[model samples]
Target chain A: MDPSRLTIAQASAAIAQGSLAPLSLVDSYLERIASLDGELHSYVLVLAEEARERARALAAEPSRGPLHGIPLSLKDIYWTRGRRTTAGSRLCLDFVPAEDAETWRRLEAAGAILLGKNETHEFAIGGPDFTLPFPPARNPWNTAHYPAGSSSGSAVAVAAGLTAGALGSDTGGSIRGPAAFNGIAGLKPTYGRVSRRGVFPLSYTLDHCGPLTRTVEDCALLLQAIAGHDPLDPASADRPVPDYRKALERRLDGMAIGVIRHFHEADAVAGFGPENAPNPAYCAAFEEACRTLEKAGARLVDLRLSPLLDYADANRLIMLAEAFALHETDFQERPQGFGRYAFARIGLGAFFSAADYVEALRARRELCREFREATEGVDAVVSANATAPAPKIDTVPLWGVFERASYTAPYNLLGAPALSLPIGFEDGLPLAFQIAGKPFAESSVFKVGYAFEQATPFHRERPPIAASLPGRT
Target chain B: MAEPIPPDRFTVLVERAGLKLTPEEFEELREGSRFVERMKESVRRSGPREARLRGVTRPREKTAEPAHIFIAGKD
Candidate 1:
């Protein structure tokens, strides 16, 4: 067996059964990173010795659990005891924490190995800015295109198979965007499903900590490790942690899925001008994908809500105001510690009056209500994750994220669970669909996601783009 | 949004944000602000409710001895 191809469940079974040694497993990933990461530049820092030591400890313990000795990467925003989490900027280059983030602590307790801190958009709100100390993480599929942000490195690192799985935060589609672009599976659970105790805040209201893995099963395995209540996290929900791993087997049969055509319809009306509309090729593939799902015994229906741009705007204001409020002191003191993009964008919060933020929130409430009512009877809302295939990194318009109200942002506003799964392909580039469930319906989303992944081969194709050498997407 | 934010105001906000925008960079930002403004306008219409930044919440049923020491946030 190519040990590298093993999903989280398979690897966990192997390790627990004494068939896989932790040191050897950790060493394999390290070798891959050394051989492959030079081209990808997906990581911010690589902690080889630390990982080896943890793996050694797990191997010595005869009864380590399933996640025992798994090597995982941390998106740079998550604080670690000794590692500097730069969040793809120079501001926090010297910042180190005394404790691991709650997710890191839980994963460590379950015997997972920390591979290293990976790169990301600055402060979870910047970008694939080249001016940062590290280059923006290039997509493993096509090095020339973005892997997406702010969890850029987390997605690319996992997609390129540098690590078994990784932790990433999603405030406004960060986890799902990169996962979709990289053609991997990711779960952005309900806002409070996972604790954000030690992770840097983007918009405290919208931010969620979740996992990016190649398979939904892997995501399930990772969520089992990360989901829990934290008295420390003020927004943390004190709900009972369900058996997410077991929930993967739940059937998706008879589930109702809504296909949103509002933004797609409106964007088309605006005339995405040939280069930007859903590529005819992608649109056809998407229809075919829907047909396949319906034939497989799931109800597919047309679903639309208000224009996507409206939801995105609410998300932006909420995120900016909250983020700026978090950084008020820093903005005053060491303003230069942040990169130009991070400072300028987050700084807008300052210009925004408190009334502006409150007014935006009022709008968010209505949007959330509309989203809930629209999705009332549906188990999941199926929508295009991207309008088209990954575009070139340099071509990403400065306003790309803002200009189009994306299919992903509405769910963020409603604080629902969104799973981005690789559904099919367009040309050689990957294509994906967004499956959103009711708030805290992570299990439902994962169940359908796992079934779709099982039925498709999209996850099998690795990015031809190499880490050591860049290629155009 | 209003004759495109003036280059001089761009200079002020750029300095306010402590960013040193080259001529091209400044121009890009000025243009980008249109998108930003559009986004802001769109978000403002999200429908009225409460605060944009979510506030803290205490557990519904406090533990007999709740971890009295609330974790101090890192700004």
Candidate 2:
């Protein structure tokens, strides 16, 4: 099998048994990035020399673990010791941290090769704004379409086979948004499930770090290396890390799956404009996906919680307010350093008074409780990953997040484990849905997502860009 | 329809955010202000009827000491 085409499980088994050389594996991915990244723009930096050196070093030693010799990318927001960590903003473009992000440290300790850093929205709040120092990542499915971000490059990298997996931090749909648009697998582990120490904070409370990969099982592999208690991260949960990969083999039989359909319906939630509603193709695909799970012996039940806008409003208030607070000094000092979209969006955070923030937090608590109660009987909850397929890059309106409710934001609010993976295609673009579990229930989320992934043919499909590349597909 | 934040107040808020934008940048942000207004209004309309003095409870209890505290998830 082409090194780039091998799933993490396959490649890891090959490397563990010495059938595949780590150096050659790194070379294969580097070559793929060299060929496809010009159009994909998935990476801000390509540490080719360093990656080769790391792979050479790993191949010299006995296998360390499943991630040993695996090539992975980090979203630029993660602080890498002695490496430029630009949070996709010109500000701090030359900044290098003295210590590595906890996630980076874990991956490196597990013997994963760092291919480079993926691009992200400025400070992870900036949307796919083009005026940034680096070009925003384009959708691999359609180069002209936007790859939803701030995990933008991470998703594109995985979707285009530029890397085996990449790490993305989700505050408000950063990981899942890009995952859906790029037709890959992304996991936003429960907040505190993965440490955020050394990663740029958008909202300390809502931020989650996880992986974007070609398959759900690969996501579990990446998560295992990164998920654990971190004393350095105040938010890190002190909990036993479940064997996520082992959990993937569990069948969904007799499990109750909660379906959140109101989120995709027009009249069900106010402020969700018609354009923001899930398209007919996506709706049909999601229904079929539910039925697919049903055939797998999972019981599907209709579930409702608070309206989607309630979660959206609360999440936006807390995120922007915290983001504004973090960047206040920088914005006040170097306003010109930020892109227009980021400045406008983060600046709006100033309008949120302490009272507004307090109220939003209170509402968040209520919503979280509501979500817990609503899903008590179910093992996992599923919903449309994105309201619609990726729109053209030129058509993504600035501040569009406020005009529509995000199906993914509710999970962030509850700090639940959420995974987004390709379900099917709509109008030639990828369509996706999210499978989420209660806080700290990533194993359950992975089990459901892996079952669906194995039962479907969507993961087998590659982007048109990949088809055009020589020796690809 | 919810009313947009008034232009005068919006201008004050922009300065308060410590941003000094060019005329073009300021105008662009002025348009974005409508979206911000909607977001604030949404929160206002959806806020819980009663306020909690202590604010939302921390989803997890912090460790008494600087020790790792792990919350076990159900299988």
Q: Model 2: runs farther than 4 Å from truth?
A: A267-269, A467-473, B45-75
Most accurate candidate by TM-score: 2
DockQ of each: 0.16, 0.23
Error of 1 at A240 (Å): 1.5
Q: What's every prediction's RMSD, in angstroms?
A: 6.8, 5.1
TM-score of 2: 0.93
Q: Which stretches of candidate 1 lie over 4 Å from their true place?
A: A267-276, A465-473, B1-3, B6-29, B44-75
The residue-by-residue lDDT of candidate 2 on A206-275, one tens digit each, is: 8999999999899999999999999878888899998988888536898999998877774224456656
Question: lDDT per residue, candidate 1, A157-256, as tens digits?
Answer: 8888788999999988999988988999887889888999999888878999999998888898889888888888987888887787676643467888
TM-score of each prediction: 0.88, 0.93
Clash pairs (backbone) in predicted model 2: A238-B69, A238-B70, A239-B70
